[model samples]
Structures are given as structure tokens and as C-alpha cells.
Target: MKDFKVGHEIGKGKYGRVHLATNKSSGYIVALKILLKQELKHDKLLRQLEREVEIQGNLNHPNILKLYGYFQDEKRVVMILEWASLGTLYAQLKRQMRFVEKQASRYIAQIAKSLKYVHERHIVHRDLKPENLLIDKQGVLKLADFGWATYVQDFTKQVKLNISLKTNGYNTHNTHYSHFKYSSSLKTICGTLDYLAPEMVKRQSYNEKVDVWALGIICYELLVGVPPFESIGFPLTIQRIVLDEVMIPDYVSKEARDIIIMLLQKDPINRPSMEQVLNHPWIRMYNKSSPQNSTQTKLTKTIITNINYNNC
Candidate 1:
């Protein structure tokens, strides 16, 4: 604690706040997530707090927020984290409204890679939203917030691929990283309802694909400046998620629209995994902007001024 000096508060939440902190000896900057132990104790969230700290501490990926280290004083727990110099994706979205499809494609593909890494390790990031995604100085996307995350072992016992669709297109389950789910038909609803999958809202057994469902919503929102199931009230939003079709705008490219449908499937079992999502055509668009293929480039003759003719 003595080695790090806290700066301005960067964010505040229900139980804690994020701050800019600098390491005194190395002069490295980091975001410190500080939680008052007393507050957690009073709320009886001690176990969840420990789990969050532990989860963040164990993750290691370039596109995942790095939890450098952590320690606890008598009063609080301090977490050292990667400082996203460009702030959050939510702030960026607010200013820009919606990103051009190309930019959004690049960003989401990076997130997919991060998801692939974590899912491979059986960690389910139950809470994934724009506010939890941070961008670094180089415009790289990183996933943050592990408060709602749980290991597949904690909830799932075995892989289940059976899912049934409604006569009018509704309830079902499919496999996307369906290798595991919470044991004993996992129970518990968490995270914001806006991005929650239908199965989650229906309180059915779910797995990592719920994260993919949220990814689909985020992809749509990134293109349209709003969520697919926009509503004026909470119940309305929940109703939409459970009953409404995922409608993509006409302006969206066909490739991007298809990926959204694949992701936001009514059945959790039908959604694509992060690995499959990244391989989809929409994500492939990220590599289409070649400098040689752009209007910005023009072929021109080059003359060498500094070269000696004798050397040639």
C-alpha cells in the first residue's frame, strides 16, 4: 500500500470505486479498484468479494484487464489493475452514438479473442457490457468486471445439447461452448437484464453462451446507437427479451446482421461460441482495409538519391 499513491477517482459503483494510482518506485500507472471491507462485511458479500478478487487475479490475457496484484489493509482491499488510458467503451459510445461497422468489427473481434481465452479456461464472465469494457492508449479493447463471473464447474455438471424451439419461434437451448454448465440445473439470475438472454430471464440452465448472447446485443447496439430490445420500462424490456424477435436494421450489412442472428438466438444452445463468432464473415471484415487497396494509396515511381551508382 505504501508503494502506490492514489490519484483522482475514476469511477464509483455500488460497493466501491476505481482510481488512478501510480507505483512510486517504477512510476507505472494503474487503476486501483478499492473496496471497503467493512461495507462488504455489512452487506454479507465477503465471499463474493473474495471470489471477484481471486478471479481477476487469476486471469491473464492481453485483451482482458490485467489484475496486477492485490492486498488488504485492515479496512479495505486494494486491487492493482491495467489502466485503460482511453477510458471505457461506454463513454466512447456515448460521444460517438454508434461506431462505423468497420471499427465495431475490429473491437468486437478483439473481445471475441478475449472471450475465447477465458472460456477455454472455464471462466464464465456473467457480466459483460460496454461499461465493463475498457480501451487502452493503443485503442485495444479489454474486458473488466468479474463480480458476476463464475467457473463452469461451479454451475455446470455436464454438456447438454438438447433444445426445442417454439411453434412461433421462441424458447430453446443450443450448444455454444456447451461442454459444461452449472451442476444440478444451475439457479441464479445476475447482471443487467437488458443484455440478458431469454433462457436467463426464464431462469433456465445456461452456460458461457449467455455471454455470447450479450455479445450479440452489444454488436447490434454498437451499430444502431441503441439495444435491439429497447424499451421504456424494465418489465417491457424483460418481456421483449423473452418474447420479441431480434430485429436487425436494414442499414446493417448482411454479414454483420447474420452474425447477430447467430449470436442472439432464442435458444442459448443455438448461439455461436466466441471462437466461432470471430471466424464469421463479419469479423473477417476487420482485415479488409489494406493500405494498397485503399484510395489513400497510389502507385508512383521512386528514385534513389543517396545510392551510389558504383554500389549498384
Candidate 2:
């Protein structure tokens, strides 16, 4: 950790502060997220933190944040990461209130592509929201914060998959679902209330479809200028999400609106997969905005060449 000289705090997270730092040898700037080991141990979150570091380190995609590497001392867990100069998606949305159809779709499409990549590896990001998304200097969106993620392969299907999302949006509790059978896993009511699918609300066995619901909410917020379930309190908001009625503002393009509607479907199985989302008509609109796909992958990979990982 001494190799990187930490600087003034640039941001704060739930359990830590992010500093603008630089590597002494390479002179490369990075975002350093410092978490107190004591707090994590007290909260019984060491496993979650370890899991996050493990997951982020293994993932590599143009639309996913780069984890350069990490090491922990007795008191603190420090992560050196690629700095997202443009800040978080939440900040950008707050500044402009919303994005035009084309701009919004471009971000969504990129995220969808990344999610597809992860899902193919049996990982589920239980928490997905504007604040968890960051924008780079190139305006490319990348996902961050994997504390709520879980690898489905590690869990057993022999037990019923009735996972109940707890209040924090990070933990889940076990409950029974009488109507369901078979297995794929990822249940227990995870994710934010605004983004929870109806099946999750009912505490039924769920899968990656919950992420699609969250992505749809993001798409709606980008175009409609506000979260569909914003305002009111948590209780009322939860009820509205369960009802599954989201009004796509008239200004949203019909194709864009249709995708949002489909993504927000009350039935999880009915929602489009991330692969389907990438191919959606709304996403196709962004294809011409960027250059050929061949160069895109190579350029993005080159940008994070300093990052080293064991699993990926």
C-alpha cells in the first residue's frame, strides 16, 4: 500500500471514503477506497467485503470498473481502482435531471452488455442502481459496488430457493415458497425497493430477472426525468412496485418506452434477458454513435492494462 500515495478525499461510501491517489512509481492516478477493518468485523461484513473484492477482481469488461489490485493491512482494507473522472451516474442525472432518448439508451446498452457477460459466468449483482454506476472520461458507464453480489455456483439447489431480501439491500433471509419447485437460485428479496421485481416482493424464488427489473427502472428514470416509484414513502413505494404499473412519459420514444414496459413486467420470467436487452430496438439506436466494435474492445482493454487479477 505504501507504493500508492493517498491524497485528499474525493468521495465517501457507505463504509469508507474514496481518495484521489497516485502510484509513486508509475505516476498513474487511481481511486483508493479505504474501509476500516474494525467496522467491517463489527458489522460481520468481512465475508461480504472479501466477496466483493473477489468478484470485482475477476470481472473484466469495457463497462465494468477496473480493480487494479488490493491488499489489506490489520486495520484497513484498501482497494486501488481505475478512476472514473466523470463521476457517478447519479451525479450526472442530478445535474441534468434526465437524458435524451439516444443518450440514455447508449448507457443502458453498455451496462446491459456488461451484465450479460457476468450473468454468463453465474454471477448475480443483487444491487444495481444509479449510484452504483460510474462514468469514465469517455462517458462510458461502468458498474461498481459488488458487496451484494453472489456466485450462484456456490449455493446448493437441494434446499428450496426461497431467499428473502432483507432491509439493507445487501443481505437476504430464508423463507419458504410453497408454489415453486426446481432450481436456479438467487432469492431472498435483495436489491433496492424501487428496483425489486414483483416475485421478489412476494418472496418467491427468483433468478437474474430481478436485475432486468432494476435496469428497466434505470431506463425509465433516465427518460422520464424521475424514478417511477419516487416520492411517497418506502411502504407506499413498495406497494407500487408490487403493482407493477410504471407510466412511461409521453416524451419517451415508443420503442424505448416499450422496452421499459417489458423490463418492468411484474412476472420475472416475462422480462427480457440482458442479451435480449442488448439486441432491443432501443439499444440498436446507439450502434452508430460509436465506431466499429473491433476497435472498441481493444481500446478499452488497453486502458486498464495495469490492472492484474488472478481469476480473470
Candidate 3:
């Protein structure tokens, strides 16, 4: 603990708060996530915390937040994390309402790249939302919060793909309509309410495709200012997610709308992989200005280069 000096509190979470800190010798700025060990133990989340550290520590990517290291004492667990000066994407959304198609596409592309890297390693980031996304000083997006993440040793060894829309009810024991063998699939119902995939809502075993489903919801939220399936109540929200068709505004570009539709397919099998999402036409042309905005290129560049990281 003597190796770093802690400063002002920057954020808070379910079990802890994060503070700005600096390494004593290196003078490197970092975020100190201080978790109360007693609270973690009381909630029986010790293993979950360890898993988060293990999973995030091993991941290396420009678009993924870095977990530098951690230490613990009798009362607290302190994690050293890279400092994202610009705060969370959620905060940005609250301020800007919604992002332009070009900006949203670029952000989505960065997330897709990061997810592809994680998925390729057989890991599933079960919880992905704007709140879990941070922006660095360079205006780059970084995926954070891996507490619900898990590593699957054999994601490809799943034995079945039979999913029936007419199933009497959602039953993992019903092999006649099971999408994947329960033994080889993840069955834990997790993730944010609005971002839950259809399979997750059905209590069916799922895989990394759940993350892909979340990507679609996030993309829609970025462009439309709210989740596609969001409703007034919990039950209604779940129903909407399972049965409602997403309605993109006519103002959204065709390419952006097409990607969102492809990503939000009711069937997980029909949803494109992270790699496919990254390679989609919208992502490929994220830097191109829309026909309606002749000055968008300059405006975008200015927004990127002149970000007031400290204020954000």
C-alpha cells in the first residue's frame, strides 16, 4: 500500500469505491479499486472477486481496461487499474443523449474487436453495458467490469443445436428443444436487465453468443438513446426482449440499421459472431462522413482530438 498514494474518490460500486492514485516511484496514474473484504465475504463473493481478477489480469487488448495488479489485507482488497480519464460511456450518453451514427459505429467496432479477442480465448463477458465501458484519454473505448465473466475450457465441444420455438416451456431437462447440452453450456441467468438475451430470458443454456446479443442492445442504445427492448416493467421488458421486433428510426443510416437487425436475431444461431460484427460494412466505413454532413469529418476529428479528459 505504501507504493502508491491515493487521492480523491472517482467512482463507487456495489461493494467498493475507486480512487485516483499514483505510483510512488514511477509516478504513473491509476485507479485504486478498494473493496471491503468483510462485505465481499458476507455476500459470499470472494470466489467471484478472485475470478474477476484472474480473468481480467490475463486479458491484453487496447480496447480492454487493464487490471495492473491487486493486494489485500484483513479488511480491504485494493486493485490497481489503468486510469480512464474520460469516465464511462454511460456518463457520456447521459450528457449527449445519443451518438451520431459514425461515432456510434466506431465505438461499436472497438467493442466488437475486444469481444472477438475475448471470445477467441473461450471467455464470456456475461455483463456488458455502457456503464461497463470506459473512455481513455485518447478517445478510445475500453471494456471494464468482468465480475460476471467466465472462462470455458471447451466452448466448441457443445453437443447440440436443437432449439424449438414451440417448446412447452423453458426446460434445460427437455433435450427435444434444448439449444446446447446443459453440461457444456452456461446456464446462470446473469447480466443487466435490458441487455439480457432471449435465451437468457428463457433460462436456456447459452454460450458467448449472449455477449453478441448484448452488443446489439448496446448498439441500439447508442444510436436511439434507449435499449431496443426496454419497457415500463420487468415482466414486460422480458416479454419485449423475447417477442418484440426492434424498430430503428428512419433517420439511422441503412448500414447501421442492418447491423443492429442482424445482431438482435431472436435465435442465437442466426446472430453474427464478434468477428463478423467487426467486419460488417458499417464498422468498415465508420470513418467516412455521412452524405448529409459535409463538415462531419472535421467536426469528428475536433471532437476526438480536443476532448477535455480531466473534466469528463
For model 2, the superposed segments whose C-alpha errors exceed 4 Å read 154-183, 289-312
lDDT of candidate 2 over 1-312, digit per residue (tens): 676678889789788989998766556678988887657754337546656776787888878887766655546667777788889998999999999888898989887987898889887787889988988777778888887876665543222222232334443434443221224765666667877777877788777777888899899988877789775887788788886488776778889988999889888879988878878888887766542234435644553564332221
- Candidate 2 lDDT trough over 10 residues, lowest sum: 157-166
Best first by TM-score, ranked: 2, 3, 1
Worst 10 residues of 3 by lDDT: 158-167
Give the alpha carbon lDDT tens digit for every residue of 1-312 in model 1. 676678999988778999997766556677888887557643236546656766676776768887765655556666667788899999999999999999989878878888899889887788889999998876778899888887776553333222222223343234322333344244568888888888888888888888899999899989998989979998899999998998877999999889888988998878888778877988887845311211111100011122121221
Top-scoring candidate (lDDT) = 3
**TM-score, predicted candidate 2 vs. hidden true structure:** 0.83
Please provide TM-scores, in order, for all candidate models, with all chains considered together.
0.82, 0.83, 0.82
Task: State the TM-score for model 1.
Answer: 0.82
Candidate 1 residue pairs that clash = 155-182, 155-183, 156-181, 156-182, 156-183, 173-269, 174-269, 174-270, 175-269
